[model samples]
Target: MAVYVQRQLDRQPERTYVIEGDADGYWKLAQSLIHGEPYSIYTPPRRVLRMPGFPFFLAGAMSVVGEDHFRVRLILALSGAVACFVVYLLGKELVNETIGLIAAALTAVSPVMAGFSVLFLSETLFAVTMLISLWVLVKLSKVQFRVEDQFQGRLWSVLAGISLAVAFYVRPSWLLMLPLVVFILILSAKEHRTAALTRGLLIIVGFTVMLVPWVYRNYQVTGHFVPTTLWAGPSLYDGLNPRATGDSDMTFFDQENVLNSMSEYEMNQHYTKRAVEYARQHPGHVFELMGAKLVRYWKPWPNATQFKSFWVMAAVSVLFIPVVFFAGYGAWVSRDQYLLLLITVGPIVYFSLIHLIFVSSLRYRLPAEYSLYILSAVGFYQMCFSSRQGKELNPE
Candidate 1:
């Protein structure tokens, strides 16, 4: 928190534009909400381009802080701290306090996590919500799927559902995680399929119920059942278009002047169709693009030019490289713990798969790094201290 505040303080005039790009949109939408104006950006007739979660949260902060970006950064820094503590709780639930503390410490010091924390982007907030959802799912994993234990199990499922819904609002891509989580829950209780199925349904019900209002609002504005935002089309096209380089560059929107000719909804549908058509017509190119995006998704260092400073690269690389190997080791040794592995490893896999189709970057992978830290802590403890303790952690 102190370091984040100090960094924000040191940036001077540019601090208002620190790590901007999407931050500008978020701040603008937030201001709209505060001043009771139309929610639109970039030559708007009130578009539903961005998700409401972060903007709404930011509006609350700006209201209290009177639109001071530094104060907003200070408030966001607290989300970073919450994420670290939640990672600790997740680690403790998965293993022991020692491993939990190690994971939390790693998250607290991670350059990528810290950098995104102070930014006005949704990653840090999403990370906190995602981690909390995973923690609830972990707790759900511990409960026996028996008729008598239905209350406890259902409660956790509902909490997990709510948390996951919150994450989805923050980042629409997370809606894809619902079916995967349901599959995991069902698979975990093979002998008690009825109970597991019931719990899964509860999760879906809880998740869907929470999203009803937002989805309805989207429907009202766009005349379509838009679950999250209309930005998906441009986001998808950003990765699959002919000029794509596996990086997000929406400048083509300006070159093509698509917005001037179409409504936001029409523009979203048009790009989505165009992107899909390009994928179908040029399968080979799509595969190559996917390959490039996969690399960008998993790269240890930032791909953005602004973050190319030698010290920045060194800090990211030094922290990430070791975590990669340690996390791999932890995953290997704990492969038998299917439930634990699902919650710890599932997110990175989910995000990686998503970014392989959408645009990819270190920023997209930040939310999943908390889970990586959990696994890395396991490896760190096993390699450095397990022998000293004279006992191995039982996967069961």
Candidate 2:
């Protein structure tokens, strides 16, 4: 891992290793926060196009390092280590120590994750926060809802919700996960429906409490209660527009110039309406685009031009293909353990479904890949060493 970081640092002027592309906004936001300037990437008007969690993280690092790219990469590399540790914890909670070690090792060596860790992107941060939240939820599942244990379970549930809120501040794609979690608990806790419902409500309260400040800020700026960001409309149209190809292309934003006569909020609503109308008008074309997105989302290589190399493709395929196969096998063997399946296999499914309506890329899937690694570890351990006499995994 240190060697990979050094290699990336050595490629200073390369766009892949430098602070370019989407990293621009994150770096700009961090500078704004550091210098006590307005939090807008543009001039004068404040905008919520980018989430603040990663920018806040970058701001702290910049305060300490003062624009030193090498030091910033080292800080993010430490975050990558934390992510691997959290993945191990989640794997241990889901299965056993051996599986946890295997999952952590795989995560530590992941080419895609290692590459992203040194860049000024939020995938690594989001992965760490999401894994911690997942680990808390897995622990919560084990706490029986007895009268004396109700308080403990509720507390864990609230912590899980707060962890999820932190992830949301990094990436808004996780917004639907809160409700999905409640639905999963309801389905899994069949006998304790009442208790489960109470926990679910508490989870909502916890999530809302953590996000109130951001929501209030958005409401003050946009005159509406915007729970997420204003970029969703552009993102949605990137996948649903008439020229959509299941990949992101923001050229329309500049070409259309609708913002010339509209507020940011108004532009958002306008693009959203246009995208929905286009999807409705061309259902067949929309379905085809979805199929294209599914292929792109699951392809065993990077989609970005900068990372398109034979060596990179070969390495990613070597890692990604085996993980997918073993994860499927793991899901099959653990089908009876509903909570295990929900925690280990849920995020990829959720993200896959959501990205069918938005832009799709391997970058959008890295945050959930850690969960897939846990499942992959289980399958590898089961197939290689476990007895074949139907001695099933006992996660309890």
Candidate 1 residue-wise lDDT at 292: 93
What's the CA error at residue 6 for candidate 1, in Å?
7.7
lDDT of 1 at 277: 98
Using Cα atoms with residue i matched to residue i, what is each candidate's TM-score against the true structure?
0.95, 0.94
In the range 97-190, model 2's lDDT, one tens digit per residue, is 8789999999998888887887889999999988988888888888998999988999998997898899999989899989988988888789
lDDT at position 248, candidate 2: 88
Please give, for residues 102-124, the per-residue lDDT of candidate 1 as tens digits: 99999988978887887889999
Error of 1 at 68 (Å): 0.4
Q: Model 1, 125: alpha-carbon shift in Å?
A: 0.5
Worst 10 residues of 1 by lDDT: 1-10
RMSD of each: 2.0, 2.1
lDDT of candidate 1 at residue 314, scale 0 to 100: 94
Clashes within 3 Å, all models in order? 0, 0
